[model samples]
Target: MKLPIHPIMEQSFAVIDREIGEHKFTSGEYAIVQRVIHTTADFEFAQLIKFSPGVIETAIAALQNKTPIITDVGMVRQGIANLVAQTFNNPIIVAVEEAPVALPGKTRTETGLLSCWRKFPEAIFVFGNAPTALLAFCEVLKNTSVKPAFAIGAPVGFISVVESKHALAKTSIPQIRVDGRKGGSPVAAAILNALIVLSC
Candidate 1:
């Protein structure tokens, strides 16, 4: 079945294309955006692209007249983390937005988010914080050799639906997402996954 771009998505895509092209990002970076937006929607699609460094690399390269970044954000970041570790030879970073929960083993697991991000300082910096913190991270990233790639602030439960969309909209980042008062890890992931295919 062929899926057309949602009305909102067409508007969003126009914004993305204008920003990316006007900025004159590298061909490779443009390619990454193209691939992620146009990647084949299949069983293997989930494992194919990455979020941070994988895509960020393309963004920086484009700016420098080098390669381009070509990736999008979806719900599968959790699973893709492992795939990125295995398949991606370069460094990568990821930032997650979550609230503080006072639990013994549940709070923040340094090893999981930290250990993975450390693999490629040149590649990654996974963050788990609020939207403000996330944007601050993006500002810091702007000073680096590579530009920031895809970013998602979708949080699950409670009032996160409005919060996530607001957070995402605040940035100039090309976020591929749907508009509605919905929030959940699975829902976010599923929507992102579907958009990855739909945007193509």
Candidate 2:
């Protein structure tokens, strides 16, 4: 299935290409970076975004295999829902929505994310907003033998954002991460949408 690009968006992409000339990213990685820049209109993502070795291929395989997708917030799930439906139609789970209440020491999103992890350890986990959730997920990954198919750590905040990303980076799990505190649902969605396009 081919995705249609509006004329305005096509022009925007052209502008992005002109402005981001001579990049180090591979073709697939560049596609993800371009989409993230398009979504946020921020060229800095080109530098902030980092991918683990072979992660693009691994992510594509997971999507094609119809792995479930767990997002830290509803916004991230909403952002990627349409493209996901058009592509693999993998089950999209919103962590905050799934957990009825926060656990004793955890935030609602963290608790929900943990619950989702227990149910779908091999799912594609995307953290676009809650650093607490990402941190909790990282801890779970440390203790468990089960690992997610892939992870996207792009939570945006000051509190624990950088730490969460660092925790994810330390793990052996394949991942795409934004190194600093400049990421959100839109960037996470753009990365997934780019992967969907690449899978096609």
Candidate 3:
């Protein structure tokens, strides 16, 4: 189902860039911002989405080098563009759900991420569903000396998502996060896609 880009769509993107320009953002900074805003049609993201200083560059380099992109849920894994995954050999991993550790009262998302972080310490971690997944991964990083490409830590929820993101922001790990509980799998995927496209 490959479709050609329509001229009107090109104009629509131009309009988005122009509208985003009122904020006077430098091209480098807003390019990705525009992508996030474009995907969700939620202009509020322009203010809420924060990135570590070198995160974009780090993400691009990882994608260029065939690094793995790990997600907390299968939805986030599936949301990534097929072209990006195939072109870069950047395998999207979210296999823990099927055979997760049997922890009492723990979501499989939590126990699974805690275990897998040890195995793929350098992979790009994307979390769009579980706050505990982000928390668990960051906790593991606390004791180890592992370095990841970066984290797309946009877990959406009310209970502990904000706190988990706050804890993550305090770490030295490079990351991108939505400041509030208004993100989803598609948003996470769009942010990653933006990085890949900008790298081009």
Specify the highest-TM-score model's number: 2
Candidate closer to the true structure by lDDT (higher is better), 1 or 2: 2
Ranking, TM-score, top scorer first: 2, 3, 1
User: What TM-score does each of the candidates earn?
Assistant: 0.34, 0.98, 0.89
Give the clash count for each candidate. 17, 0, 0
Residues 119-175, model 1: lDDT tens digits: 332332222222233334344444556433444443333434445445445555444
> Which tens-of-lDDT digit does each residue in 41-152 have in candidate 3?
8889989888888887788788888888888899887778565654676877783573356478767888777666767889989988888888878787778787888998
Which portions of model 2 miss their true places by more than 4 Å? none
lDDT of each: 0.36, 0.93, 0.79
> Which whole-number lDDT from 0 to 100 does residue 177 have in model 3?
88
Candidate order by lDDT, decreasing, is: 2, 3, 1
Error of 1 at 178 (Å): 4.0
Q: Counting only residues 3 or more apart in sequence or on different chains, how many pairs clash (N, Cα, C under 3 Å) in candidate 2? A: 0
Q: Find the 10 residues in a row with the least total lDDT in model 3.
A: 1-10
Question: In candidate 1, how many Å is residue 32 off?
Answer: 14
Worst lDDT 10-window in candidate 1: 65-74
